[model samples]
Target: MTHTTKNDPVRAGLDRRGFLRRAGLLAGAGTVLPLLGAAAGPTASAAGTADGDPDQLFQAGEFAAAGRIYARQLHRDPGNAHAAGQLGYIDLLSNRFTRAEHLLGRAQRLAPDDMTVRRRLADCFVRQDLLARAAPLLPAAQAEQLASVDGTPYAVDGPQATRVPFLDVDPLPQVRGAVNGGAPATFVLDTGAMGLTLTTDAAQEAGLAPVSSTAVTINGRTVTTYLGVVRTLRLGEFELHNVPVSWTDGSIMAFPDGTVTAGTLGTALFYHFLTTIDYRGRALVLRRKTPAQQRAFRAEAARTALRPQPLWLAGDHLPCTPGMLGGYGPRVAVIDSGTLDCGLNTSAANAERAGIPVDWDHPIPVNGGTATVYPATAARMSIGAAVAHDVPGTVGPTPWEGLTGFDLLGNFTHDFFKPFAVTFDYTAMHLFVG
Candidate 1:
């Protein structure tokens, strides 16, 4: 099955809207990773276990911690140019261009040929849309990605259900469905998923003939992908039409850990109905939401024990909720069952404030590159009374200064999400972490 390229698959005469994501990086398979382009832009040499090691704090999204460590390093050794340069780097990520220029300039004078200082300052200038400023600082090849466009969005709709789609969670939480009205197929119920993704094998089995192809990068190689519609996708009593889909030769955002389903029923489809994931009872509920019912549901949602948090819509229009990091950040975190542990995808500054221990020896592997994320355990994470102790997690990067607090909300695969029922109402822009 070959998919020829369609000029622009997104805007090709379908109902479309933007689905926003708060974090800059795409999360890894059951792991959190920054939606960062490459590690070539800027970096610094590592110091001791508890200092402003860019790889450790910067990549772990612990900007707050990195800032503190750098400040301490500077206080001890006022003339440490390395500390000054790193501080300048923080300013750059935070969009404080003037200050970044000042600090990096001083550090540059101190160490005339520091590539790290040069590249960071360049990236900072690029963020401000000042090509001339960045031109002198950046290499020709590196500048292109600095100006890349945003990812594409999709439109998803289904027939009004005569009966609500409620079924047992089957321990693994997979429900039987069909692709293009073919034989029954398996799909994992995942709220953290960005969209309904299908593997090439599954797409072929379903006779998902590709109409157009889109080129994307993975593992540093450009791969051509097909985009088409799943004309008649069935899930229980519901029928979905013209659901935009992508095929994968490699693993994608993937279904849960153990089972290999045909595809995932992620947020794209979830937006159309009232959804509930009941972990204790092992049940999944889906019902159409009428205007009056939506209003009533939202009013009742306020009363649920599940702590209600503000879920922002990403460029993709997915829900992002506020969550605390080690009891410190009531900040942005995407609720991803796809990610492992409560991975910290924020900045070093926010991470240091959380007081979580940093694992300096290892770097977490992202899609094509790597991040300096330290493994950490927790005292307790406050997801509004639903807390998990000693949770397995990673601290990631805080590429921008302004993004210090936002990180991925703890992944739902953790035992904590197993007790109570959870609900995410896209219309209401609210998530119930009950």
Candidate 2:
């Protein structure tokens, strides 16, 4: 959430007393129950109702709005560790390392027992490529592993730019990839993932051994995964060395043509360059994030009439942008290229608030099971400078919000990006499409 925007009216419309009441900060009467811990103030709701309360908004995937409210609460109560920590988390999501350090440090000082805050602080350091700074806050085993790679983590050696031509483009973007000089296998370019992810079959085929193990949630199910490092990864014309990777027992996907997708190349790998998933061009472009390269890209964009839209690196790697649902005010939205079926996916409350009626009588099929998801047409929708009317989408629970710390109003899927040649400028935190 930003301090200023065209949607500032939504923030202005909320008076102090009403905001406090909705936030459950007022006296007993009309008090709403807190969603999580009592000390952290109010949080969320059940399935059907949509509350404008900050906590409810946070739980309902309206993170930008919730963040604005949290900022206000922090302004009023400087000692509120919960508020500070939440702001810090938002900063971490935005890739504002210094701001996250300050806020999380203050929150840690106020509530020393907050492990979540501490972990988030460590994550901030890790994202900045400072393993030494993050070591002390991590567990002994993880710290030791980080210390081992303190000298050179994710070392890269290649040209300034490389293009990985798509091998399969039906369900998602796939390319031929290899690990540690292993045989080439089909891999997905999934932006939803953090680092490199591999299936157990692929890991075995590539002869990788586990360095550590951790629990992760995939498709609403928790699964155990083994972490390892790739001595070298071959993707198109580039080579990345000393890269951390994780392997799980789960199968990502199998193409109808009987091609097995072995793994994924995620943000941790692409953040080193100005990456572009050119669906129209049928290739993944990786350009070095150098001053000359950025200047050349800007010049090309101007020549081609491509508009650059501001984006935030949220959570581990989600590219979030300000967007509107139907006619509702702008909120945080993630551009997730991984979602294949729908152009847009959102929460029921947000859909209802935006004047799109949810058809609870008819449910839709999802990956795990059937859900209260239905097809609907948004009268008006927008993300950054891109706008559309009568857009098709799906409205449901949106379980992925948990992965992103409930910091999104919806997800614009690969279908939404298929028409353009999209470029992600990580350095400037901007997205350009043509």
Candidate 3:
């Protein structure tokens, strides 16, 4: 849902009122690392015929409230394609891919022309890495182009340096940067994203040249995308060249909190450096690890008893780690920064294996409403050695395959802000919460 691309329009045209916002990333199957929230980030559908305060709740970011409203509506009209479709769309926004697939698929059967349901169902397939299934649902040219997307490897210029101020936007971190050496433009820092993302307006203002194309889902709408390279992207003192950038309709630029952004900074560029999100200070620090610093960190890890979680490569070239959910079993979770809630969102299998209890009592939020999200809890959940006892989470069947049989973990800031820092030491492949 979060990952996208852009260029010339592929379909006949897009009606803004019906379009969903641009978004985060394809959830890695093992850990299911898709960015789920009310932001214009990774979203689901907006097309069900049902209507009510659910629409307002979805817009208000009260996702749980919206889902409950729709679930109650479904009780009166079990065969309503609109209710089922809308519920499924919300599930997708909440990162419940399998649920989205089931609902959206049923919706499509009930209302074949519901473009929103079709697009969202395709998104469920894409999120599951079933590219073959998604390709057929999108424009042919866009599909062929996406099949060949190869971004350049990122390289940090110098030794160790950089500490830039940031603005906390709900669950996201906002920073300023120059595009093609242009004046400063605001960018949402999303770890779930892969490369640089610019709305067409921003890309044009920065003079980017398009070279590739693809169709991607944002919220519940599908749009054509062209891949281009930026000559130079200057973030504070850190200057990066040959950066892969996505250009799409200006939809991704709008944040849920009402802030308009020029683009997003994803993990593709961040992985090359050891980065830290200083929550209290609202700062972003990027530096190459020095041998001395690495040794010092190792010693500190031992002292703090910080378990070292190995960062492994996931789709879109992001690093992930094998962790335990409810301390029940091992699941590879992505270190995602673009999320709206706390704790892990798990598959039924993962939750069951860990012995987590599900009440089938919680409501899941979406783009325009909500769906069923069971409340579940874990006795203990750990990433490396960083553990949370009596962790709160949701469990049920999901559309995602999961990163090594896991979904996602924590609100990067809200849940983990108590630590001195939540650091990603890419060079050493370790995540430290201390």
Measured by lDDT, the strongest candidate is 2
**Poorly placed runs, candidate 1 (over 4 Å):** 1-173, 250-258, 295-307, 341-348, 398-416
Q: What is the TM-score of each candidate against the true structure?
A: 0.57, 0.77, 0.58
Candidate 2 lDDT score at position 152: 64
- Model 1 TM-score relative to the real fold: 0.57
Cα error of candidate 1 at position 428, Å: 2.2
Tens-place lDDT per residue, model 3, 179-207, is 77899988876665555777777889899
| Model 2 residue 231 lDDT score | 80
Candidate 2 TM-score over all chains jointly: 0.77
Q: Over the stretch 303-414, how does candidate 2's per-residue lDDT look in tens digits?
A: 9777887677754456777678866867778776665445677877888788976566666654334244677767777765666666667887664444456546787766
lDDT per residue, candidate 1, 380-413, as tens digits? 5656666666655665643222222223443324
Q: What are the candidates' C-alpha RMSDs?
A: 12.6, 11.6, 14.5
Q: Which should have the higher TM-score, number 2 or number 3?
A: 2
All models: lDDT? 0.51, 0.64, 0.55
Clashes of each: 44, 0, 27
Model 2 residue runs over 4 Å out of place are 1-78, 138-150, 215-222, 250-252, 355-362, 370-372, 377-380, 387-392
- In model 2, which range of ten residues has the least summed lDDT? 26-35
Clashing pairs in 2: none
What ranges in model 3 sit over 4 Å off? 1-159, 217-220, 289-293, 296-307, 352-362, 365-380, 389-393, 397-420
